[model samples]
Target: MSNGEMEERIIDHLRRNGKDTALKICKALAVSRSVANKHLYDLEKSKRVKKNDGTPPIWDLMETPDDPRPVLKTDTVEKVSEIVRTGGKTGLKAHEIARDHGLTRKTVNKHLHSLMDKGEVLKTDSNQWTSTGHQDSQASGDVTVSDSVLSKCFDIIGKLGKGAYGCVYKAQHKYDGKMYAVKKVKLTGDADAEVKALAKLEHTNIVRYITCWPSSQDWESCQDTSDQSDSSIVFKGSYTETSDYDSPGMESLSISTESESPAKPSQKHRKESVDPSNPSTTYLFIQMEFCERGTLTTWIRNEKKEQRTIIEIDQIFHEIVSGVEYIHSQNLIHRDLKPDNILFGAEGKVKIGDFGLAATLTNPNGAAIYRTKGRGTRSYMSPEQELHSNYGAKTDIFPLGLIWFEMLWELSTVSEKAYLWPDLRIQKCPEGFCVKYPTEHKFIIMMLSPTPHVRPCATTIKENLDRFFSMNHMLCQKTI
Candidate 1:
């Protein structure tokens, strides 16, 4: 958003793309051609970018300096002068003029600088140039940041995702050769709060945080020697790679229910921090455990494609409840719990993540919790939550119940033959579950109870699940 950020982006883009035209840069970053061109020109003035001699003109990193033999054409100088005139009295920076006329910043700067030396174009104190002799200036608070810090630390493999805030990149630890998800979060203040939040959380059902540190350098200076390309950079050889790397839907987590079992967060991997002298740097990087299975959202869809029985999905639900239980025990409320935040880890285990909206129970030592308005996905919202009343642990009960019901219906056909379970949430139980499986149906209804006071806590849900598994051992043996 700032001038430095724009230029740093150009540097990173050129690193991945090799040699590209200005048009390609504009499209990829969604910046105006003028903005891109202006930034490119500023970078050119700093001797960081270069332009090709070809017809349409290709832009790339300045691997080497340009050779001036013919001394640059006179008409080119006049063209840059014309661009400066368009900006009125304020004139423009070298990059700004280059942007207006679709010229290389390096070429434009050369001519403009020469004109200033010869008393043709006037240079101002703010580094802006004007042909009209009047100075136009505006104060700027924008700071430039580098995209190459991950390159300095890890072997950046490729792009994971990009949004309004920043980007997520796939990377591998240079020392361990293990894969990681490098998420770039914008720092509103120092990166301490997020680090502390991640430190307080540790459990098998929770997404483990590796280490978080602030990068003082912007993207340009941090380039990894291994990341040399003009497109999404990839490190070759033995590093793990997957075809699903480009998808933003990272994990559906069901696939993580593999044989190896998800790794629990060890003491050694907790709370590692790196503090640069200047914490005012714009970006904060959080390195997290990478799950190749993708998100639970993808996992549900995979079931439909594989046509797998819903029986196994029942186990996944139990794992999810286990995660919820851990959070509750820690005196924390996972205000937002749905399939998307429910990630599948290595070895097919479920891990709850994205604690962005989580809140404390106020009293860590007792069963009493502070009541607050609801905070979670609407489809799975509890009755108490929908009313915006003061609620606690029971709030999570409703959504997890709805999700379990949906999974029972859509994620598996095995649930259909379970006798009492319906394809949808119906008021009446035709299979006489209210009488025959009275305990199971009772537990579910307690979760969806209209009053938070009557709803069962997550610990109770886990205990009830244990009962369900014990009552029907045969279902466990019949794998899809």
Candidate 2:
């Protein structure tokens, strides 16, 4: 690309990506810092872009109008002004600017708002950008990727769904173009919780954690849940950085998490959660493996519609157990486990995901007594977790039973679909669905045992699964 083309590309990138640093620009556009700087240096003279000075200077593209107005003599304002004027009474839509100007609808909308606020322009009743005198109107994809920081690393394909902490997007890596899932989170300001836990994990059944970078600066901050004061935490971060680091991923990124209180609980629900005092320096991003088949919730619901024989049901169950077992082995408790958290990987394999709610287990008496302020989804939560009391690893088992119940109900005959969420104790037991695999059914029941203490361990749950598979080996192997 010629230097002029490069400048246009820079403007185009800034428009689409909301805002990003020059380093990210160089990385995404595959240009050197010097090259990007040279063009940016020239563009600034034309008033088409502005660079903010900071740790890593940020570049913002201004909306420029074609016919430069006396007031908006600068390239940006003139460019935007022309676009609006061209629409006349019809008025230009934000997306229209996006299409012709290689700018994002968001940037156009923001510019329009600013212009309207200053009486430089107006939004018609038609909800379009126009001169302040233009008459009336009205007014959006579900692309599941960040429109800001993560956009530098991945191109958002579509949104999977909203998670507890943030929205999950199915994104494609910028360089490799391989697909991945990116969970854009607020993380109460820092990513210390999720990142530290995930970094320690390396397992097949667990969703892999790819490298992540925080939003170099807060372009858009997420609205997070209100704080609740309750003392319950597990992994308080005892480890230190090791030399066994992966490649120094981001040249401009010096991301390191620090805690003054090493003795602090790994997880805690505070009453007055402080906002990120230095929010400009924070915005956590989580990138992980994308399960092509989507969440187990979607999968199960689809099965209800198709009534297709889901042969991999047993193996899927086995994988779920294996994943939880692995998590438990790491002294981490996935406080939240539901059909939604269990996603399908390549082939018919299942991997556990969404550790935003995971808490490290501190064995006080050969058991993890979680003092968390109510964790887990209400439906899948164990009786103890629901009560918000101190619990242990067994707390996780309670939900596995619920998960198994859900899958079994999904796999059962069409007639058995009516009460998928019925009391598991009497959950279609008479119809013999649960009776089909007695050992498996028995383990599920034990997992849901009212007293968490008696609930089977993840290890025991897997053992039961293995035994059930053994007894039905011939039938199972042929089914999936």
Best by lDDT: 2
Worst lDDT 10-window in candidate 1: 237-246
Question: How do the residues 331-403 of candidate 1 rate in per-residue lDDT, one tens digit apiece?
Answer: 6776666666677677877888655446566554664432333334444556555444345777777667656
The digit string of per-residue lDDT tens for model 2 on 1-480 reads 667567766765665455678887887678999998889889888777887877788888764566332332334764776678667777776656766777654456557655553344665534466775321110001111234555455554444444333455555677987877666554331245567778888888888898766442332222223311121111111112111211111100101112232122111211212235532223466788877655676666657634533345777888888988998899888777777667777675677776765667875466533243344456567776665445677878877887776766654543454344446633334457655656566677777787878787888778866866776776756775
Each candidate's TM vs. the true structure? 0.50, 0.52
Model 2: residues with Cα > 4 Å off, grouped in runs: 1-149, 163-165, 216-281, 304-311, 363-370, 411-422, 425-431, 434-437, 475-480
lDDT of candidate model 2 versus the reference: 0.59
Task: Specify the highest-TM-score model's number.
Answer: 2
The number of clashing residue pairs in each candidate reads 32, 22
What TM-score would you give candidate 1 relative to the actual structure?
A: 0.50
Cα RMSDs, all models = 19.7, 24.9
Error of 1 at 93 (Å): 44
